[model samples]
Structures are given as C-alpha cells and as structure tokens.
Target chain A: MKKQRFDYGYILTLLISLVVALLIGAGILALTGHNPLVAYRALLGGAFSNARHIGDMLEYAMVLCLCGLACDIGSRVGIFNVGGEGQLLLGAIFAAQIGVWLKALSPWLAIPAAALGAMIVGGFYAWIPGVLKVKLKVNEVITTIMLNTVAVFLCQFLAKGPWKNTNKNIVAGTGNLPGSFWLKKLVPGSNLSTAIIAAAVITFLVWYILQKTSKGYEMRLTGDNPRFAKYAGMKTERIVLITMVISGMMCGLVGMFRVYGAEHIYKSTVSNEYYFEGLMVAMIAQYAPLPTIVISLIFAILKIGAMGMETAAGVPKQLYLIIQTIVIFCMAAETGIRAAIARNRERRAAKQDVKARKEGGNEHA
Target chain B: MHNNIWSTIFDPGTFSQMLRSATPVALAALGGLMTEHAGIMNIGMDGMILMGAFVAAVGSYFCASAAMGILAAMLFGILIGLFFALFTVKLKSDEFIIGCALNTFALGVTAFLSREIFGLSGTSGYAVPSLPNVTIPLIDRIPFVGKVLSGHSIFVYVTWLLVFLMWLFVYRTPMGLWIRASGESPETLRTVGKNPERMKWIASILCGVFCGLAGAHLSLGYLNGSFVEGMSASRGYIAFACVIFAAANPPRAYIAALMFGFFDALGLRLQSYVSSDLTGTIPYLITIIMMVYVVVSRQKRRERLAKQQLQRLEP
Candidate 1:
C-alpha cells in the first residue's frame, strides 16, 4: 500500500476508454444512418468557428469553472453537496432580485452588489444542510438532493408569480435587468463579458485559499481525518460548515454569471445540468482548480459542439452525455486498474525470485 | 380553495391520486431497500428510472405493447445495475459520486435518444401503447373501497404485492439475512465462506430492477405512454429518502412513500389556491423536514446510550 508515482499506464487506460466511448458514439450514429465524421466536423466547426462561437463557449466555460470549483471545495471537506443545482438557482434568484432592485446604481456598484447578494444567498442556502450535517448527523447527500427540488420550485415560484415580467409574454420569468447592471463586455462588440475574468480570478483565489492558507490546511485535515483533526483540537464542525458554505457561494457566483452577466433575467429555464456537468468537469480535472479550468473549457466545447451538431448534422446534442458518462466510468475505475497493474508487477517479481533461487542452488551445488 | 385541499384529501379522488403518485415511489423504494440493506445506498435509482422510462417508451412505441415496454425497461435496468455494481462494489469507487454520475449520464443518454428517435424534447403523448386501467368487478361494487382501489393500472396493484414480497424477502428469507449481514458485517459473511461482494451486487441489481419497474410505471401505467425529458423527475431521490426514513424496511418504506404521495396530492389540490409553482415545493420541504427529524432522534438515542455506558464505568 505504498504510494506509487504517477502511473502512465493508468493514463493509457483513460485514453483507451475515451477511444472506446468515441467509437461507440460513432457506431451508434452510423447505425442510425448518419456519418459520424461529418457530424463531428460540424460539432467542432460550430463550437469554434467564429468569434461568436468562441464567446459562447467561453461563457459556458466560465460558469462551469466556478461551479466545478464549488463542488471541488465541498468534496475536499468530505461533504457531497449534490445540491449545487439548488444553490446555483438560489444565487440566480437573489442576483436577479438585487440587480433589478438596484438598477439605478452605476455598473461597478450594481455588479458587485448583485454578485455579493448572490453569494450570500447561496452560502445561506448551503448552510442549512451543513448545519444539519454537523449538529444532527443528517446525511448531507439526501438533504442536498432534496433541497435541489426545493430551490428550483422556489425559483420558479418567484420567477413566474410575484417577480414575473408583465412586459414579457407568458413565460415564467422576471424581466431583464437594466442594461446598466449587466457585466461589462470583455470585448465591446462581442458577447463575451468580464465574467470570465472574474471566474479566472476567483479560481486562483480559491486555489490560494485551499493550498496556502492555514484555514485550507485545517479544512483539508478535517476532510482527510476528522477524528484526527478533532484530537488535534480543530473544530471539525466549524470547518465543515465553512467548506460547505464557501462551496455553495461559489455555485451562487456561477448563477450570477448567467443571470446578471449573460441572460440578464431570472428565468427558471437555466440549465439544471450545470451542477452535474460542472461536477463532471471537476471529476475529470481531478478537482484541482487550475486543471478544473482546462477541463471545463473542454467540456464547454462538448456542450456547445453538441448543439452545433444537432443543428447542422442532425445529430442529437445528448450524445456528449454518453461520452461524459464513459469518461466518468473510466476515471472512477482508475483505482481498480492501478491495483491490477500492481498485482501483475508483484507476480512477475515473485517468478523472477523463484528462477534466481533455482540458478543459485544449482551453481552452489 | 384552502378548505378544498383538506376536502380533497378526504375524498376518494384524492386517494386515487395518492395511490397513483405513490406507486412509482413505492416500487423504487423496495429496490432502494435492497441496496441499503446490502451496505450500498443506491442513488443511481434516478438514472435507472430515467433509463427505464426512456427504454420502456421506445419498446412500446416500436412494438405497440405495454408488456414489452416493461420488459425493455427491466432489461436496461439490469444493464445499469451491472455497471453500477462494477464501479461501486467491484472497483471500490465512491458510491455517491458514481450514483451522481449515473444520474447525469441517464439524463444525457435518454435526452439524446429521445430527440433522435422521437424528435421531441418533451411530452410525446401515446408514443407507445398505453397500459389500461383494470377495474375489479367485485371491488368496484364496494362503496368507498371500490372508488379508492379499483380502476388503477396494473402497477398499482403490483406495488402493493411488491411491498409484501419485498418485506418477506428482506426479513424472513435466509437470503434476506445474508443481504442484511452484508451491510452489518461483510467480514463476518466472508468468514462464513460467503462472498459479501456478490451479495452487494445482487442487491444492487435487484434495486435497479425495482427502480426500473418504477420508471416503467411512470411512463406506461401512470402517465400512460408519454415520454418527456425529466419525466422521472425527483421520484427516484424521493424513494431513496423513503429508504432512509424506513430504515430499509419495506412496510415502513411503503407507508413513508404513501405520506410523500399524500403530500403530493395535497399540493396538487392546493395549487388551485396558491401558486402552482409554490405548491410544488411542498413535497421536497416535507421530505427535508422528515430527514431532519430522523437524524435528530437518532442522535438523541446515541447520546442516551453513551450516557449509560459512562454511568456503568462510574459504578
């Protein structure tokens, strides 16, 4: 059970799994009477073809990066906050409410106000499960999952009922926030916003907090060995609460990106898949903040590319989910693959020892 | 309208709605109990149910048979069960993470296939042959009982039977002991020349099958030949919570699911007075509160036991 160095063999296995997944996707397309190559070409072209496509993909990446980081932080503290969807939705709800309420403010003031409002809401939402988990030993997983439905329903109620836009059609959502409250464009003529820049900064800040600070050390210690941390005089309960709240707040920020930066409305139709997809990106990245950014970027391509494939090549956008599933299955089985390799090495070593003894005995005799 | 919600609960119509709503959850809870007793919590029930919902519809839509749809769902359920078993039980991966991944995968794959095959994002009505409601002649003649129980799809009756069967299987049978033993002490089972891992695999697959039927019930029996994105919704998770609430006991789980259903039916009725969206939050809020109560009571019991142990030491 000694720790082995980074195993290239495991990486090879992951590569093979990816190939298998791609081949399966291709085969299915072919069986359904579509050319896989053509479909993939269209996907890539649509996701990366022009400035607009690039901007859209980046926007997705930014949101995913933040959400992934949220889940990653929670995991580090051994809390499975599967209710990221709920937290994200709550953040969006707050952002929309606050953004509209303070529409008269300058862009800088309104932007921070909306984002801060979202973070606080998301944090408080997550705190419920965290407090329950620490004090009463409630399974955070179930509580989080249940809370997700609760969050969405609440968002829907607010969007469609009280806060619903009378100016807009029958769709259940608030009117767009004033244009002044919108996050400034990263490029003046493009769809891209400073949100990506904000996301990047937040990721770095999270990384710094997780790796460098004393608080991060305590949190990681609590996650690695709660009993040990407790014995060492650390307040494990407080750590758990802090980690979960921060994770939820990060999710809230991602919601703000969509509501205040991109969509500019409190719509219940926000992609519920973002929470899961963000978690998937984090899983692929092995939960490192920097690598999370890269994986999220890759995931954004898959997401946007699939939509493009749907429009141009008549392939379903959901094919990417299959690919993502395969990736998860492959990654989740990494330990098994590692164990197999380790066993093979031990068996060969034993065989070599037997042969060496035989030769030594013969020579000595 | 507020009074109407209470009135609806007392009426047979609401009872029918409650039973219908509870059927899928009860079915899935039976499966969830297996995994819970086997030492693995099956969160992937959501995905399995989704897969079952999609595949069952595909089977019926193509073959024009309700039975074929259920069979198709069960088969796909087995496949998902195998994969879940392989990753969690066999590979030693985190069960919760794998379950979450499976749910996402199910949503993605089903959405993809639905769009490709049916060219619809949501609500393909009667894409397959709908299951017929069976009215028992004798039972239909009984006043209130008849109105409440009769004229239900076959799954409704099947769920009632499944609860009893599951209860017997988990509590009475030797296999049931082994499954429970696996969760309690897999090492002890191993010492007795039994493979605890194998037991877990069986329980997981059975859980898959149960959730599959639950999903089938949603598409064919409840909604009757409709396919939509997220049609399974949060029922799988709700069933999971029922398992926790019931402590993996079939009868308790059944009752718990009924309560969940009762709330759902009440919420639907109450929606007439309140915002439909607001009422939708009722079931989730109630579930969370139920969990909180269970956890707090459990902690209190543990504390009492600890106090007793300390008193013994002092004496």
Candidate 2:
C-alpha cells in the first residue's frame, strides 16, 4: 500500500477560492455602498472580540461539526443523506420531549434517555430511506428531500399544538427543559457548554472509525465499488444501511446538544438550515472527518461574525452566505480550472516546439 | 356531509386554483424534462425560479410593465443557465453539488438584494405591475367549463401552448433526438459529428427559459407581483419529480404537476376541517407516495420479466 501524500493542490485550490470569494464579497459590498474593509474588520472583531464571543463561535462550531460529520459519514458509505435536516429536527423534538417527560429523574438518567431517544428517532427515520434505497432501488435524495418537508411540518404542528408551551411569552415551542437537564456552560453568558467536549469525543470516534478500523475500510471499499466489495464477500447493502443509521444518529445527537446545551427547548426554529450549511462544509472538506471539523469552525466564525457585521457595518448578514456559495462554486470548478490551465500550457509548448523546429530547418537549408 | 365535502373539494374554484398552482410546476417540470432528456440533472431549477421571480418583480417595479419584467427574467435566467453549464458541463463538476450551491446562492443574493433595493420590508408593496388576467371570449361565455378554463393570467394559456410545442419538439425534431442521444450515448452523438456538449448547453438554456417563465407566473400572476423569501418552496424539486414520474415526457410531466396542484388545492379546501399545518404536508406526502409507487411498479415489472425469461429458458 502506498502512503498517502499531503495534498498541497487541494489546499492551494481552497485558498485561491477563499480569496476570490472574499474579493467578490468586497465588490458586492462596494456596490451596496458599504465600506468593505470596515465590514470585514467588524466581522473578524465580532467573532473574536472577547471570551463570550469566542465561546459562542465554538458552540456553533460544535453543532456544525456534528452535522458535517453526519453528511461525511453518509457520503463515505455512498449515500447522500439530504434528510439530515429532517433527522435533526426529529431528534430535537424527541430530545425535548424526553427532557420534559424525565424532568423528575436525575440528570444522569434523564440525559442518557434523551440522547438515546433522539438517536433512535433519527436513526429510524434514516433507516426508511436506506432500506428503500437498498431493497427497492428508490433514490434516497428524492425521498430525503420530500421527507425533509414532511419533518418540518410535523415538527411545527407538534410545537404549535400538543407540546406547545402554555406560557404567554413562549410562542411556538415546547417549554424549556428542567435546570438539572441543562449542560454546564463553558463560558458565563455564552451558549458554550459541556456538549462541546462530547462533540469532540464523537469527532475523534468518527475519525478513528473512518481511518483506523476494518469496518471503516469495508465501508469505504463498498462506497468506491459495490460490485467489487460484493465479489469479495462483503454485504454492501448492510454497510450502506448501517452507515446511514450512524449518520442519522450523529445528526440526532446534534439536535440533543442544541436542546440541552444551547436552546434548552424545542422550537420550530431550532435549526436555521444548520444541516445545509454543514452539508456545504462536508462538501468543501471532500467528506473527510478531520477537515470537516476545521471547515465547521471556519463556517461557525463566518456565521457568528456576520451578525456583528450587520450591526456594526450595516451590511446584511446574508452577505456571508453569498461568499460561502461563491467559495463552493469555485471549489467545484477547481478540477476543471486546473485541467484548462494544463491544456493551455501544453498547447503553448507544442507551438514553441513547432517554431523551434522550423527555425532549425531554416538554418540547415 | 359527504356530499358537501365533495362539492367543496370539486368546485370550480378548486379547479381554477389547481390550474393556477400547477402552471408554475408544469412549466418548471417541462424545463426539467429538457435537461433530463439531455442527461443533465438540473436540480437548481428552484434557484433559477427564485432568481427569475426576484428579477421579474424588481423589473416590473421599475419599468411598470409585465412584459419587460418577463424579458428581464428570461435574460437573467439565461445567465444563470450559462453559469450552471459552466460548472456542470464545462467544468465537469458534480451537478448535485453545483445545484445545491446555486440554491444557497439564489436564496442569499435575492434576500440581500431585496433588502438593499426594497428596504428591510423586502416587499415592493403592490407598486410592481402584475400580469393581467385574460378571458378567452368563447370560453368565458361557456358555463362550468368556462369557469375552470377562462379568466387566468395570459401565461396559463401560454403554458398550455408551450406544453404542446415541447411535446412536438421532443418527439418530432432532430435537435430533440440529438439531445436525447447526448444523454443516452454521447459517444454515438460524437461519432455522428454532433457535439453532445452543445446539445446539453441548449437543453440547459431552454430549461432556464422555461423556469424563468415559471417564476414570472409565480410572482406576477400567482401572487400579484409580490416576491416572498424562498417562495419557490421546493416546487423545482417537485417539478423534477414530475419529470421523473412521467419519464421525461412533456405532456405526462404536466399531468404529474397537475396531480400535485390538485392535491395542493385539495389541501387548501381541507384547511377548513384539518389544521393548515397538517394540510400543507398533503402535497409533499402525495409526491413521496407517487415516487414510491413508480419504483415499486418498475420493480414488479422487472421481476415479471425475469420470471418470463426463466420460463422460456426452461421450455
């Protein structure tokens, strides 16, 4: 087996894309009459001004990391789980319900029950598409997309109806979990909590599974070539199903963390397309676990800091989203761009050779 | 009670609403069918529609002409199509990833530009010109049928003509054959001296144009020139589903979209009895079931074919 070489090309492409996207963002800001420099400065300052801001960024990163991992694991198993948002929502609702129902129990029992409940709900939700894909050959992407809309509506209905908080101040959500169920905050007045440590541990486990385990090897092999894996006596179907469930469970865990560590309640707006952003992170990282974590942190910074830019520089927070999409577009075009460059160089070299040979022939004549 | 429920669900108003709602989906699906036949999965139709809607609203707001607004939307749609082609066709990037990115881009840019141009309210507030309703003279004189068919935005009639034209183009035109061949066998198309890539680009452009019309109808006709955030609302995806369910056939895709429209209309009517939140899921739930039904029937057909082959071999 060949040792894996450090990918300088990918990093270079990523850096170039980042710069191009930022420049485009600046151009957009200029068009909108905002001072780009001041906006960017405000963005960076907002993300890193104090311990509280840093903590908030980290908290966002934790949620993004788990969501990215969810996507990464699905891609690794040759499944595109576009329903991560749906699974996360389902997991969140379950976690909140468990938290509320188990209010009388000790934190140890309540937390575990809540976490398990979320995992089961998310995993079960994912398993349907997985089975459909493996058994019926139904496209998971379409099913997942449809399921996402259904899940959103279901969650909203529950929040607005049966489980709605009766408190006049609370509008569209379940009541907050008991204090005992809350995760210990890492920074006072910030959303950061002990959940970050759990997230880190989960990330490490995902890395270990993907890089160090035989099962992970089989999964990757199946993803790369199902026919070859099947000929080699591996049950590719089971691997796909298991990987999908695990991915869904990770998403569910993110939902649990958001409830216990951040939001402390289940609301219709519990997640603001965090899974979609996380999917983008996973895509940019090429579906790798470690890079997903790194990219998640960067995305978290952009998200958190965008608010500051909005307040301080008077630029819309949506500007960062535009920047992020531009970056993705550039990244997607990286291979094509490199290929074009190589083609141009080859054409030039051929022309040079022709010219040199013609000159040599003239001299001989 | 049953008779009243049936009467409510099957009213002329329901049919009119169905036609109105189905118009955009049908248009998008027809465009999606073009890309589907050319072997490109253009999931970014939603984003394209969103961009078109925003641009059309803005254009009408400024020019005070629905025609100019549609023209602007079509132009912008072509640009978006080229952008999509540059990535998916020229750059050979993953179509799914590019499509998702386009969606995110559309959502962000539209939201940002709407805020910047229209202020924080993000609405043109009835200042924009809407597409006028057209009453077919003879049809308007008819009874129940007239009520269902007449007095719609001009695009509704235009969509009906386009659907028929699209069917003719796909089944009767050489360019359609080339596009189909491009998706099915690019090498064969190349052997015949036709550029499959160019056909793909043409399909992308056509898809963009149709989606542009769909968006124009949505904002100007359906909603009275009002642009809402994410108003496309996965209708593009539903359109793509329509294309798949109909096997990329234009008329069939329109029928599939009509099915969605019918359910959506029914959901609206059912809102009286059921909660609006639950009713909203009806269309999406039906789409999922339709997709599953398609897959299951296909599987059964394959199984029957295999059984037939086994019997022939034994004999």
User: What is the C-alpha lDDT profile of model 1 across B215-284, one tens digit per residue?
Assistant: 8998888888888888888888999989998989999999999989988988886666788778888888
Per-residue lDDT tens digits for candidate 2, residues A184-299, read 99998888999999999999999898888998899889998999999999999999999999989988888888899988999866798889899888888889887788888988
Instruction: Tell me each candidate's TM-score.
Output: 0.94, 0.95
Cα distance off (Å), candidate 1, residue B278: 1.0
Candidate 1: DockQ?
Answer: 0.72
Cα deviation of B225, candidate 1, in Å: 1.1
Q: How accurate locally is residue A207 in candidate 2, as Cα lDDT from 0 to 100?
A: 86
Per-residue lDDT of candidate 2, residues B153-272 (tens digit)? 998899889999999999899999999999999989988989999999989998898888899888899998889888899899899889888989999998999999999999899888
| lDDT at residue A221 of model 2 (Cα atoms) | 92
Give the lowest summed-lDDT range of ten residues in model 1 chain B. B118-127
TM-score, candidate 2, is: 0.95
Could you tell me the fnat of model 1? 0.84
Interface RMSD of each: 1.3, 1.2
Q: Can you list the residue pairs that collide in candidate 1?
A: none
